[model samples]
Target chain A: MKKLFLPFLIILLLTSCRHRLVPMIGMDSNGDEVIEHVSAVNFKSSSADVMNLVAKDTLTTLSNHKFNSGWDMNHFQVGLLINTTVGPLAWKVSATPGFRLVFKKVKK
Target chain B: MKSIILIISLITSATLFASSTLPTDWYQPSFDKGANQNTLSTPSAQADEEIDHLFSTQHKTLKRLNKNANKKWKVTDYVFMLALSKSGLLGFKALNGKSVFQVYYQKKKATPVKVEESKPIDIFVHEDMTDSDLQAQIEPVLGALVATKKIDRNTTLSGDIVERINSVKQVVGNLEASTDKKFYLSAFRIDLGINSSGILLPSWAAHKGTEVVLRLQWTRIVKKGAPKALAYKSKVNSNFQAFTESVLKDLNKIDESPLASTGKKAVKVRIGMGVTTTDAIIISSAKTTFMGNLIFKRNKKYKPSKSVVTNDYQYVIDKSIDGAKKMGQISNERFIKGLNKAVKMGGYFVRKADNSKKWKVSMLRAWYILSVQGFMGLAPITATSEIELFYK
Candidate 1:
């Protein structure tokens, strides 16, 4: 029985070594996964003078990849941004036919 | 002394067996020990639970990834096919719409052993030659070539021929009639032929199941309201067949794609004018606004490009039929001019809905009609149409 146990243990060890898991990750300066959050705001004035009081407030919120709504009765576009360990993704306002007002996270 | 020896032997064997098999119970320590024994023949309950949870998460993640991949493939394929169709039509039109002919000859078992193309071949009609004489002349030459295996005995030719002819004649009893010129069209003759003497194979065998050959001939002709026998002379260009086969190959690839799936949901978009009124004054007491909304919907597994998604909150107007009707028309030239100015300003615009129009609208009213005729960054669609309304 003792002789048989030694052979079985050796076979089990060989089989277990073949199925080891390898981790897939990247090494940055800190050797950790990188993730960031972003928020941006957009404000604009109405040339027609319909909502003049809030236009300045609207302009303050506008930034790269972020938008925020201004006061009520005001024409403004606002958004929240999220950046992750993966590639950057954007969601933004379509003010013109071909352009997007986008917002992104600040580098940590 | 013998009885004492027997008792000792039993006690020794029991200890060896007890060490070999661990107890099967829920206690953690006992379960762990049992896991290492070959004869215990049971797994720990916790291990089963861990494996189950791991597999469940993996299954769910794989499902989501598959769906996302499939959706992307569907959208890309639809766009690709639309592009290919346009490309194929444009390529053919630029070439003066010339017809192509291909021939294949088979020496053994109707297999096209040799294939060739005759492109841009001129069709000559011997006006004075009798139909029987023309046929007799061509048949002998063709037969001789086949007999010598110079041309495959099983060569097939197919093509389309378009032509128009006019002639002047004298009338026997009265004046010749004035009329439009007559037209004569020859149907292309396509066939599969093998040149047993050479190694070139027919286009049919090259394209395999992707293409079908069509053969047309000029069996009869009408000239000046009289029925006349038709005769045709054909010149062959061998390269045209290969060109056509290449085109057909691309078409087959497009058709086999997932975009070819029928009855899938389609994304529909329309751009028109919308007019509205506001209380704020620009240069006068009240402002009259005429604007366009680039209204859209993703419509089941469809997502619009980010540039086309109207993020200007004003464009999300409340549901109203009157508002929708106003969306159907512009106020006047004043409103249209003002709207165009706003468009030039680059901020997205939205229209307001009145009470009467908003209440009677249908669920289809969920979609907004874009005001501009040409929207940039617009993806190719599987189907598209436009509607124009009259003032009446």
Candidate 2:
């Protein structure tokens, strides 16, 4: 029983992590999911149109990556964990013209 | 004296010249140039001007009458003639003792006057309306005409009166044939009554059977701009079917039934669904009921029976909610939250009612009020949905 307990604990931990809940995002007027935050490296210089273009590019990149795919539950859970833990650190070290996207779910 | 005579002679010569230039018989009644020249007629010119003025006035009056015809009678030519006569425009002094109709007819002989017939008034009547009911509807219009002095009260049985009645009848008939034939989407409600043949017994009593009935009712809003032929009945039916199937599918997902039995005997469970629509705002709400036998066995797993029977009834609660949300009546979050609360409350009540027979009636009678607040800080429009539960 002691020998099996470690494996059982690991399996339990893995299973619990598999079903982690993510925040729900609000929709825009066009029914598209709205990003909670958008940050550009040169905030003062970047116009609204430029920021919008950057946001769209970021969205497309995030969409193509397997981890950020919302359609798959396992991918979404994994993405939520990784993005929260490592996303901020990566944004700090990124080059110019960089932007960070953050999504926050609405409360019930 | 010589100067005075010369001035008088000059004035006489000027008068004679003016008389010679003027046409002969200029002072005559007909003002006719004699010897086969009847060109200059004063009375004829005066008659032409009077006729033009009469027609122009009639045209303006008709336009005003037509503008108000939606709520009043469409002014016919006969009515206009009567109005003109009443206003003294067609009196003896105006038309020289001849009626306006006679002058109109006389002018029509020389130049045809275009008289536009009144357009048919749009009316809708049920096919089941009786003759007396239809007559009652038409009586107020004729009465209004008589009250306004457009029609003579004493001459109610006259030919023009009959003609006016026939014209109204034609309008009613045409409208009934066209407008009432189309179908419309109507708001509706569903009621499910569950009855069981068990005495009001304690928890230790034996089990009994149950029966259920579903009732559906709808009311239509008949208006000019109402959507026609939307296949709304079938759409409602299909939507209702989807809702029921979803409920059944969710129920089937539960691995263990709440009412588990130890012995060989089977447990009884009852479920019901009800839908209702409000008339004023077209708001639709759905209620669900769950009932079970109190006889339970601990530490045993029971499968839900697959033989639960439901009637073929339609519902519109989900569709109505979606529509309301689309129209911005309620926020999406509130909508989802309300539904989730309803399901949770339903399950909780069902379990509580099943455990104790004493609390069953009271628990079922308790209503779960799901009040949805209006969106965008508008005046709070509360949509209340009642959740009911029952058990035997």
Candidate 3:
């Protein structure tokens, strides 16, 4: 009975759900388990603004061997100096659209 | 006396040119940037909150109008459909005008699924909206919410208005049926986008970003109404299964993107990396630098000066930390995560259906994307969006 208890505890710990701070995922790549840490940022703008940015030319094609063979790199971004008026407040802005971009690994 | 006049004119001309700090062709529209209003002024979180307020407020107004259970004017029966799509163009059009969406006005057939007890909403549509016009619209929404103290002035409305509309309907539906209440007002919204497919797997190539996201509630209790619209305005027309096949078959025959307006012009570029604090920054830099290499490879005009690939590039930093300091670091870190998921969204759907294992896509993965707030937003150029690839 004591031996059975030890195995149950091990299995419980391995399969338990835990709180995630960065909200990331781990996957299998080329038969090896790969845990790539993706950024945890999100765009705080509206649907109109996002599509306008992407539809406009923000997509770039990248080639790299480090990426899995099945995927290609495409960077989608809207780096604008937004004159945002939040609630009753006024507007200030940013340059470089900063780091808010959608980097996708698409297939050829 | 004539010389004096000439000197005065010269002084005026010099003053006008003095403040022109930017280069001669700075404002010229290009692929990188633009001087358009859509490029300059963007909507805020406050603007989105107003979308919710408008629906809720319109619902309330609608309820008052629908008091007569037996009356034809009562909104007990309506016909509509959610116009959400995976195509950026179709999705954009869906929100551009009410015409693109399925509409059934006074006496159409629709079933309000479920509902909760809450006040209804008011709806409004504008022909041409300017920046200030949006602010003017938000004024009343904020005013009422703050007045009732339901929310504060500084609140950020990050909630999906589309999903909320459904929840409100579900709750109101349930409440009205169970408690014999009269919460007869409901609202619906659609926000959508086509996830970015890199230069290789362009959405134009595969009919990937096309689908249905329909929901309409004509009544808490079923009723009848006349047709408000003659036909579905969806571009891809999911009603026809052959739509995707014909579109893809035609697209496959093309050598370039269907829309020549995309400005497929590519130039030579090299990417240089800068250092930063977080390990994520280093990882992100590597990804970005690789992207730079991609641009060089994709462009026809770019020529390699040396075999080692050292020259002709754009310099990328670890983060724009020096720009605004903390914000730069925080923003870049978040971008890394978003990029990761975007890749997943892009590759997952396409890969799942791989029949020969040469990277075919599957139906289940494709559905995951369509079902998932599910993704990407902006503008008094109004649109419907789903937030995805995000963190808590």
DockQ in order: 0.01, 0.00, 0.01
User: What does TM-score give for chain A of every model?
Assistant: 0.20, 0.24, 0.21
**Residue pairs of candidate 2 with colliding backbone atoms:** A24-A105, B190-B275
> Which 10-residue span in candidate 1 chain A carries the lowest summed lDDT?
A39-48
Candidate 2 Cα outliers beyond 4 Å, as residue runs: A1-108, B1-237, B254-366, B369-383
Question: Highest lDDT among the candidates is held by which one?
Answer: 2
What is the lDDT, from 0 to 100, of the residue B287 in candidate 1? 14
Candidate 2 lDDT over B1-392, as tens digits, reads 00000000000011111211212222111111122221222223433343343333323322332212122111122211211111111111111111121100111112222322122222223323445654565456545544654334433222332333232222221211112211112222222222342112211111112122222122222244444442223333343434433333332332222223311111111222232222111123422211111111111243445574343322222233223332213333333333333333233323422342221111122122222231110000112223222211
**What is the DockQ score of candidate 1, to 2 decimals?**
0.01
In the range B1-392, model 1's lDDT, one tens digit per residue, is 00000000000001111221212221111212123211222333443332233223222222222112211111000000001011111000000111110111111112111111122222232344444544554455456546665545333321101111101000011111112111012112222223443232332232223222212122222234442333222121112222222222221111111112221111222222222233111111011231111112222332223342111112211122212322222212222222222221111101111112212101111111112221111111111111111000
Candidate 1 stretches with Cα past 4 Å from truth are: A1-108, B1-135, B140-220, B227-392
Q: Which candidate tops TM-score? A: 2
- Model 3: fraction of native contacts: 0.00
lDDT tens digits, residues B1-392, model 3? 00000000000001111221112111111222222212122223443332233223222222332223222211221111111111111111111112211111121222222211111332221212233554564456545645654343443321232332333232222211111111111211212211221111211212224231112222332112323232223322221112212221221222222112322211111111212222121211222111100101122332333332112211122222112222222222222222233323323212211222221111111111101111111101111111111100
lDDT of 3 at B72: 26
